[model samples]
Target: MTSVSLVAPGDAPLTLPVAAAPAPARVPTARRYLMCEPRHFAVEYRINPWMDPEQPVDVELAVRQWRELKGVYEALGHRVDVVEPAPGLPDMVFAANSGTVVGGRVLGSRFRAPQRAPEAEHFRRWFEANGYPGVVMPERINEAEGDFTWTGRYLLAGTGFRTDPAAHAEAQEALGVPVVSLRLVDPRYYHLDTALFVLAEDLVAYYPQAFSPGSREVLAGLFPDAVLADERDAACLGLNAVSDGRNVVLPLEARGLAAEVERRGFTAVPVDISELRKSGGGPKCCTLEIRD
Candidate 1:
């Protein structure tokens, strides 16, 4: 398979300092995941920095890549559940934004962009149909797992872009888990999952420049040994990955970070979803882990 260019047109090259990842024994565990087919995926409108209408999108390619990602989960012995795609809701393929699931309860999404607002209802219906009842739809704008990512003991909630700070407290109250608010400084990494990812219960990986100084400090304190991504990987949305403790499946375009993950004692499984990346999403964007 041909890999997409290291950087897209109009994407200024970002070369920053890199750090070595310390490898440690991490056992893999099967997980239950929810994904949506990218049948209607397109770059019709620009809600984030990554979307450019001039950049052509291929729905067929997106579907194939999405299926490959789903297959990766299945091959890893994980259960993959699908939610039907609703036409006109192009971004529905990013199932992670549908909701934040912790302790088996769903915290529904409220999209900040009007174009994606309708997606919440469609996702909510899927949860209900799939036996997830009484899903808490927060009044404040929170893009579900896009902004709210659970890191074992606490939920690392993001703000300053799509999700509101108020939504952080709402999720904490609803999920009964402590929520730590991280302020995203860059539009490119608007979601918490985009900049920070939990690799295991005690380990994580992140792009430091994507977050504010205070937020970065908090992350340093929380996980001092977290794998830090260089600009090349972070630019390709490499930090947006799904890890099953021992295995990490991420965008193939983020090869630099993939190597880092492997050095950190995790098997890095890379898949190309360049078509989907045209809309600012990678592997983690398409996979939502249901913590039951």
Candidate 2:
């Protein structure tokens, strides 16, 4: 009564099996790092007067102050990654500021100051020992100490002061993540973090003068809840604090910033880093927190 016939399609079509959605990647957890005892940049102003008063830093005190700061991070339940001091490399002592940690990889950076070149080696060894992806030293480009920032989702590469455009591009390419290159017109505004810090994905702390008008507009649009830190507060370690995912470690001078941080329900812990600031660095500059 009823006959059913199956017929192939008139035209042959090539088809591939649909790939199952990749398992959602596990978000890396935030882990803190402690650098080796502080070492001086060997500037004459820092050196002893009898020997060389012009040294830019006082090594003995810097080392002690560094350790104190390191202890604070430890108290926050973050793991510490330490590097031993190198003999010939003076700047190697400031390892945290030299490189950017992207995901599981640590991209060794090239420095603007020729004297800081030796700093890369120590970072290489540290990354290797910790079972992190191999360190990639960006070739054909040089990045300065203030060139980079690992702001959770994206890496910010500041161009002009210590990092050139080429260096920023290389870091972005090697990391395989998006990078935003900010044009820094003012030499004093060396790093993006110097004038801007991401307090939350939608919130930021910034100084208007630090960014160009275009960048400022972009930042304001992206972070509508941004709390603008007064210039005086910014100069006083306000912008140099760290947000441990949820809470923040504030600098003592950032009184205004701290008040806002607390209002937002973040635990704002004020740290005294007068010693580090003397060298033009602060809390954020002292530690590199690698999120795993």
Candidate 3:
């Protein structure tokens, strides 16, 4: 009965179907996640638009915020596993870029930036050392979970930024899953996870302006009722929020996004990870979902 205004890549308005399907049941399942301590976190170089070398970083505050984010997972009945943060590798704290894990198989990371390239090997070792079987590292550049998002059915792969187009095929081959490629044009929403994330198996929330016209149409067709975030939410890195189907954990500054999810029959749990965002990361960036 209610009208939903959907936006294409260029901010073109697209209305929802007159007769929409019934809302699905919201089920919160426990998750197993991998995170890195912000012990060595800092903004030494500018890789993304959110990063600024001029602005100083407070390691103490970053650690505190990161701890709080980890705490949020614990409170949600989710298992939080930590990988040691190596010295000199500052952005390692954003562990979600490490790689993708689905059905106990991993498609490892191959970073685009030289500054963050070493992070891939470090993450690869963690997977192999931690009982996760054969971790296949793609030769082509890919940011792993950062650009490849598992939507429970298909892998929404991203390109035109960090991940290379060839990596999508490698992921499909390595992980034995279907991948849908989405091109990102905006520098701010460099990673697909930053511009969009699955709220449930059949649903996702995204910022349309970050995608191309064709990619936006593909998303609109796939998720008709996907939550659309406003400029305010995107600015706060709100679409980077992580959802366990029922609980959505996002940045506290993402107030508009929190309200949107809450209205859509989901619990919005906001955390203050502002210190981490200084390096172009939020809740989802720091947390890597390990689906087994």
* lDDT tens digits by residue: candidate 2, 62-154: 677677777777787777778877776644545556567666666776766666677776777777787875778877444533557665566
Tell me which of candidates 1 and 3 scores higher on lDDT. 3
- Give the Cα lDDT of each candidate: 0.90, 0.65, 0.91
- Expressed as tens digits, the lDDT of each residue in 1-292 for candidate 1 is 2233355588976555545544568899889999999998888999999999898888888999898889999999999999999999899999999899999889999998998999999989988988889899989998988988888899999999999999999999899999999999999998888888999986899999999999999999999989999888899998999999999988888888888888778999998988898999999999888999
Sort by lDDT, top down from the best: 3, 1, 2
Worst 10 residues of 2 by lDDT: 44-53
Candidates arranged by TM-score, highest first:
3, 1, 2
Per-model TM against the reference: 0.91, 0.79, 0.92
2 or 3, which is superior by lDDT? 3
Please tell me which predicted candidate would have the highest lDDT against the true structure. 3
RMSD of each: 10.8, 14.4, 7.4
Candidate number with the higher TM-score (2 or 3): 3
lDDT of 2 at 224: 79
Model 1 Cα displacement at 218 (Å)? 0.4
- Superposed Cα deviation of residue 119, candidate 1 (Å): 0.9
Residues forming the 10-long window of minimal summed lDDT in candidate 3: 16-25
So what's the TM-score on candidate 1?
0.91
In candidate 1, how many Å is residue 269 off?
0.4
